[model samples]
Target: MSADLVLDGLDKRFPGSPTPALRGFSLTVAAGTCTAVLGPSGSGKSTLLRVIAGLEEPDAGEVRIDGTDVAGVAAEHRGVGMVFQRSLLFPHLTILDNVAFSDRVSGMNRRAARSRAGEYLEMVQLQGFGDRRVGELSGGQEQRVAIARALAAEPAVLLLDEPFSALDPALRSDMHDLLDSVRQAVSPTIVLVTHDRDEAARASDRIALLEHGVLLHEGTVLDAYRRPQNVRASQIMGGRNAVPGVVRDGSHHSALGAVPVPLDTPTGSGTLVIRQEDVAVLDGGVGPADTGSIAGVVESVRVTGARSEIAVRCGDALLHAEAPPTQRCQLGDRIRLMLPTTAVHIVAD
Candidate 1:
């Protein structure tokens, strides 16, 4: 059965390091919920996952699953399954045997273990590849088998550590959909570690931002994107256009103009993080701008087959706006940029 996962004051440090990899990390994940842990490299995203899986021991803090502390439990006995970036399947073992390894290790009869493994393989859409050697499958197929292997253990918590990192862009999307399907098939408490923001936004029920080995922010994907806790969190969460602004209780004053955001703050200096996709480029034909419009000269335009990314220079600040390929935007043309009140995030840190 699935269980809620909790961590409190989790601190882990490698010997000789000046700072801890995980510092005072705490989180509560509801049962059968998928929480994506997001962070840049060396930010303890993987370390936190390892600690929860009992692969790494925290110097201090407690890891509780369903309100029971499991800090002293061995890795295999923790009832957690991990799918690493690379599928470390045994070369000599067939796909079925590799998937069933967990069951066999748990002392199940060979026939029963094989049957259970077959079920997981079918769930992962690898129904007939059971007898194929692990060396013969493609990378994406191997990852599917690995996921099946992890689930075959019947783990209460599934931890995926960048499971789709090796797959190509197209395959990555497919794998994402596959993960969503798996979640629907068997709702287990899942913790996924990823650097891909779009993937996290699409798959995660909640996105937890981690930075410099610290848990920076935790919220719904849209909330974290709309109102990031800090500047660092904003950058990682796809705040491409970072604008320096001053908060004036009701609105923010930027190079463009004083635009109202969906937040109230004490009158102080702050920065605004605007998402490129959220900033709509208005052509005279698209629509008429309302009150919160700032005019800018188009600096450059980049076309990527189906879509165009236009860079506009408004005073000292440059805004990157995503436009359609058919939109006739040219360099040196004066364009009006409108940042929706809800799209402009006032982050004061």
Candidate 2:
């Protein structure tokens, strides 16, 4: 069965390093849910996962599983399974034996272990590939076998460390679907470490963004994307439009003029953040003096596949917006943009 995982004030530092790998980092993941740990390289993403799996002991803090502290538990005794970016399957062993290695090591008979392995293979949609050697399968299939092997151990929690980062986009998507099916079948508590924002959004119920060994934001995927708490969080989540402004009398005053803000917003210097898709591009006929509208000249237009990225210059601020590919706009064309008050978020500078 699945279990709740909690990291309380975890701190880890390497010798001779100026900064700690993780400092006072804490998060609680509910049972049977997936939480993606997202960060750039050297942001301590792997260190966090290692601490959770009992591979690296924390310098301070508690690692709890189902309300019980496991501070001194050995890696093999921690009831955690991990899959890495590389498959690391034994080349000499058959696919079935690789998956059944853990069970066989635990003293189960070979027949029984292979039988159990077959079941997990079917779960990952590799039912008939058991007889094939590890060298014969494709890269994606090798990763599938790796997953089945980890699952066959039946650990309470599973930790994945960017397992699909090496695969092509199409193959990566297939693995995501396979993970969904596996979750439905066994419901293991999962913590996925990834640097890709879109992967985290697609695979996990919640996202925990980390930077410089510190927790930046932790919430649902939508919350991290739409309701970031600060400028750093906004930038990490791919926010492009950040207009310098000051909050006064329930309005934010900037180059775009005074836009209404939430009544509870404190009056102070802040930055106005809005997602690209939220900025609506309209014809120049729309009056610039309208309540939530501003006039700008198109500075750049880049069509990428199905959507287009538009850059508009209004006064001193350049705002990036997204529009349908069919919505043609040329450089220097005058346009009106509607910045709905609800979509405009004010964040601390």
Candidate 3:
């Protein structure tokens, strides 16, 4: 059965570090759901995972699995499987032997453990490669073998700490697909720690954001983008344009001009954040200019995949706008930019 993982009011600090690695950190990963603890380096992302895995002790609070406190539990008895960035597979073992190592150590006989490991290897699509040595496997294959090994243990919870950060972009994507498929088979409660937002979005059912040892936001990925908890959350999750403004009579007055806002918005100084994709640049087409439209001069354009990120200078505020790749835009081109009122999410400065 899958276990629900919970951490409540967790705090941790190193001997000489000025800031605590985790401060009043609290979260709950629902049974069988993948929750990515997303944050940048030194943000306590790995520390949080370590505490839950029983590798590190917390200064305060408790770590619980299925309502039982596990603060004093040994790492091996926590019923958790961990896949680090590297494979860390034993050099002397075959792929099958490596996968079956944990099971055998836990008292399963060699035959039974290998049988179980073989099932998981096939699940990762490495059916016939079981006899191959770890040195002969590709990086992606090694990571897949590592994942297969973790799942083979049949742990109640699985912890993946930047497991694909070393893989190339293409291979990383393949691993992501493999993980997505593998989860449906065993369905372990997973906590995926990643610095990449795309990885977090693609791999998990929900997201828990941490920054400077603080638990800033927790919610579904869509809601996080639609309505960020604060200015930093808005900026971090794709809202790159944060414009300084003040609330006046249910509207934000800024360099771009008055933009309508909710009546209950704090009536004072604030910042309005908008996604670059939401900013529509008019070419005497798309959204034509009127008093409601704001105009800016195109400063630069860079194509990224199917869209072009165009920088527009509107007075003192320079904003980024994403346009279709086919749209013709030139530097120094004066264009009108249309920002729908709904696209503007007000956040504290």
The top-ranked prediction according to TM-score is: 2
| Local accuracy by lDDT, each model | 0.88, 0.92, 0.88
RMSD of each: 2.3, 1.5, 2.0
lDDT of 3 by residue, 1-349 (tens): 4799999999999899999999999999999999998887999999998999999999999999988999899999988889999999998999999999998898999999999889999999999999999999999999999999988888889999999999999999999999888888878899999999889999899988899989888999876675677777776676778888898887898987888876667888888888888887876732556655787888999998999999999888888999898887889888888787777778766
Of the candidates shown, which would achieve the greatest lDDT relative to the real structure? 2
19-94 in candidate 1: lDDT tens per residue? 8899899999999999999989999999999999998999999999888999789998888999999998999899
Better of 1 and 2 by lDDT: 2
TM-score of each: 0.93, 0.96, 0.94
| Pairwise TM-score winner, candidates 1 and 3 | 3
Which ten contiguous residues of candidate 3 have the minimum total lDDT?
Answer: 283-292
For model 2, what is the error of residue 121's alpha carbon versus the real structure, in angstroms, after optimal superposition?
Answer: 0.2
Which segments of candidate 2 are over 4 A away from where they belong? 262-266, 284-288
Better of 1 and 2 by TM-score: 2
**For model 3, what is the alpha-carbon lDDT of residue 168?**
97
TM-score: the better of candidates 2 and 3: 2
Query: Per TM-score, what order, best first?
Result: 2, 3, 1
Residue-level lDDT of model 2, residues 1-349, one tens digit each, is 6899999999999999999999999999999999999988999999999999999999999999989899889989888999999999999999999999999999999999999999999999999999999889999999999999999999889999999999999999999999999999999999999999999999999999999999999999998888788778778888898989999988999998888886777789999989998898875444555667888889999999999999999989999999898788889988888887778888877
Model 3 steric clash pairs: none
